[model samples]
Target chain A: MGRWQPGARERLEQAALDLFLDQGFTETTVPQITARAGLTTRTFFRHFADKREVLFAGEESVPERVARLMAEAPPSLGPMELIAEGLAPAAAEIFEGRSLDYLLRRRAAIDAEPALRERELRKFSLMSEALEQGFRDRGVDDLTARLAAEIAVTTFRIAVARWLDQHGDPDLPATINQTLAAMRHLTSHGGCSPFLTTHDEDHHRRDTGQLHDG
Target chain B: MGRWQPGARERLEQAALDLFLDQGFTETTVPQITARAGLTTRTFFRHFADKREVLFAGEESVPERVARLMAEAPPSLGPMELIAEGLAPAAAEIFEGRSLDYLLRRRAAIDAEPALRERELRKFSLMSEALEQGFRDRGVDDLTARLAAEIAVTTFRIAVARWLDQHGDPDLPATINQTLAAMRHLTSHGGCSPFLTTHDEDHHRRDTGQLHDG
Candidate 1:
């Protein structure tokens, strides 16, 4: 019986998450996920390599999309702003077809499973790597680019956490913006002259020149 | 033969790293490590649960020490500064009695294996958790405390990588300071008003009162 539905992949993921949440990730099996989705195990295999991959498949394309967003963003934007713009597409895409309840369930499953958590962190690490490369491509100093990428990713994690915690449907972009501002606040000196004031002019001038060339 | 040396644990770790590098992490066995250290298998078991434990044993105590440093740091120091202070002891302790060569080799062994890489990242995650708890204990706001801890840990990680890379024996503390300064430079806006200016004054006043009470 060769049967593959139009929404087989989404149905499989939704079914897998429901099963994982109903019992536990370790107890959930491919047959069970397929049964719940009203599909064959063969169809499930076609979509995901394994149960773990089901939760992580969405994250693979995220880095490429984010890097592209940053690369195409207006040159006048600062590194932090550019990163925020890059993250917007990811936020929208990840939560696009999923309901709030479905996302929460998915997050809960991930949280309850150590294997899933590791995969999640690894994906975030990959995203940071992509972001760092994007910054280097844009001619930012190596150290600054790396540090900025780390900060932006960290802020994104916090924003996602906050977005999930809200009682009602949350505004992910606004929450991310807030998280970025909070990160800036956490790192800033209290009422003191800005850090690296003397180097600012040279850095910005170089940044402008690079942007023009790009 | 029951020949257990004075610094059996350190000797075992050194032996393990050598074996790991000479062969590979997965190929190197408990007997090889013990034999290289001139110790019994029992001694290795007494020291570590397994070969992987040799690389991660010290991380368990790190959060406690770092949190203590942060809690006792001068009240006048800002949150970011306090976190840097908190991380100083960790840098010293990690490199204590370890040669630059030893550190590099240990890192190489860890890098060579995916299992070790996951362990390393998990340890870093634990460090961030500890730092966040320490900040909360110090009465910093939740979001700010969490973000501050993350930035500090990230900067520390970069510092460690850089310290390991330098040809000349580098000072870990100074490297950490440099990384912190670099992070500040990345986050700070040029000549703009400070982030959380009013909040800083209020937080400091409360912090001072808490210090006096302590």
Candidate 2:
């Protein structure tokens, strides 16, 4: 029972997700999880530090690998492109193989639970920090590095949302590229300055109306 | 006791900060805060919904003001500039009059506590959402608007950090302007593509190294 079997972790994760969905995260306990998995509490403890850890099991390694990839990227590549490339491999490894059902269920559960939502936000913050550090290591200034990191993360999120909607096509890289292209078009086409133009138009309209009245 | 007096809220905030600093946030209680402020526990509850709310008293109004400003901004301004203009008034109103000591102490306390840190992240996320909404209302696409909002938030954060270090000399608006200028320069200089170039260079190096060894 204590042996490190290949399917042991997956079995535990499946059991935990089943329990969490049937009974809310608050109502589920470690003993219940292990009982459902046909494993002892000690085995569960060995696999996960706590119940919360189960949800975040591979988070540590995923970010670490992405960061390493960014750091090892060629110095000549632009910041956004470097991040995009680095994230592609990890997306392929972690997200491409996964079933959409699990992700949808997990996302729904997190959205419903405040504690889980906070944890999820914290995870995104951690990822941003890692990306920022990667940029700084590559000689980007503080503000640019941080901004680039934010943009990269934002693009990744947009891509993931689109991918999820597509019923798990596993083309996260393509989705991210599409998002980046959209941003470029928006910025280049003067999308950012629309507010200024709108204000001017409003003022002109007011003046025209007054002239007509006169 | 339940009346909303003008200065009552400020007095309570001062007292709560003092108690939080003297004894850690976790160790301090509502009774202690009220006792220091020469008020009853009932008064504290009336002024602030909870102890955590004391730290975040006026923050709820910030996002609304920012959104309004963004919506009313001149349409001719670019997305980045539009966001900068929208943020300036709100930043001035919320952060301009605050003492450096108050800001530093509040930041330190929030950084030292995990719960407070999570709360801070959540607040930032909420603000980002509002900014995104403002952009969308102005005819920007969903993904572009979200990324612009995130970049704006990142710039605001960097500016605020720099402002906090100046010990009360520079105003929030000026600092924010400087940060925005830096971001514009960086973006225009092709900084975003560095990550991509770097990744490609690394790939090339790896391929060359393997070929040389072979």
Candidate 3:
């Protein structure tokens, strides 16, 4: 209820989120959401396909939008740079203007429900494919493009989780930048990284790991 | 059943897979699976929680095993090296000795079922956390550990996807190594990466991306 002034769709989203968190996603119905919103069930149906869809509104299209952004990125940028640069705006669009209280509750709602979590993960998989397509369409090599898409999505997801964990202070785009920096820091180091370059070394370390655990 | 020489667990697995593929996951029953395997419901229950659980045997403990391996990795290895070295053994233990046909069919069954796919995704989430713990235990910083863990899981998942897509020919560990290499390649690059280092640039690129799409 904190400064959430909006249109019918936003109102419906808020109402559905409230019902979802209060009574649990499984127990809450469209009728309940509509009643809570002081709108008609027709309004609920107009906004979302079903009760579950209320939580994942716009998720299906998010990947497509992000993919298009990736396609439009300057070829001069590295993949990590492209992803950090491309995904930041979409992250801001979805998360920046929203109330922190509104988002935490929504995240809680999705986390509490298995079905919603599943839907979110499915969307992530779809996002990865769409991101890969974005890179492919821009003439990046297959392996490089695929790796970048997956890594970008992973970085974005981690940044969002961190933003929430930190109570949403530094803005989503900044958090993404922070995560992008850390990700680069982790991968850019190359001291002992011909790891598992041979099967014998792989076996030796694996057996040693097991022996220590045992 | 080709070259699947094993114990009760494997027989139940094969029988359950056969039924799941022959019929949809939702349509299959534990009793039917047991009947197909010529085992009793007692044995079936002894091995699985439900019909759905048959598709994800040993998945719950995989993260723990992986985490232990990470903890046991040489402290001198870089986090990237540690993850590659740690994850390969478990990957081998799960996928190496198994028949390619059996593995492919198993993947197909899980992919065809939403619930199974959900369960699998949940396992990956858990693996990310376990991997994070593995890194944390070894004194990696919070951001680097989290980024590395999430990135490692993503790399493993993509590698597995590639292995399956390539008809499971190369050993799973080989696929994982290749994927790890590609992931490193994606993140290691520093050029143009000061990605979204500034907010004004982020907004500019975002508006441009939108304009092009529009």
Instruction: List chain A TM-scores, every candidate, in order.
Output: 0.83, 0.81, 0.81
Write one digit per residue (lDDT tens) for candidate 2, span B109-202: 7877888899888888788888889888887777778778877777777788788877645877888877765555344334654333655446
Please provide, for model 3 over A1-214, each residue's C-alpha lDDT reduced to its tens digit, 9 standing for 90 to 100: 2233257677888998998888888898888888888788776777789988877777778877876677667876666667767778878765645788887888999999988888888888788888888877877777777788778778888888889999977878899888876676566452233233464345434532322434
* Model 2 / residue A7 / CA error / Å: 2.4
DockQ, all models? 0.31, 0.34, 0.35
Give the chain B TM-score for each candidate. 0.82, 0.82, 0.82
lDDT of each: 0.77, 0.73, 0.75
Root mean square deviation (Cα) for candidate 2: 8.6
Model 2: residue B60 alpha-carbon error in angstroms = 2.8
lDDT of 1 by residue, B75-124 (tens): 66656657666566777776678778887888999989888888788788
**TM-score for candidate 1, residues paired by index:** 0.84
Looking at model 3 chain A, report the run of 10 residues with the lowest lDDT sum. Answer: A188-197
Query: What does the lDDT read for residue B137 in candidate 3?
Result: 88
lDDT, candidate 3, equals: 0.75
- Per-residue lDDT of model 3, residues B27-85, tens digit only: 88888888888778888887789888887788788777887777677888878778777
TM-score of each model, in listed order: 0.84, 0.81, 0.81
Between prediction 1 and prediction 2, the one with superior lDDT is: 1
Query: How would you class the docking of model 2?
Result: acceptable
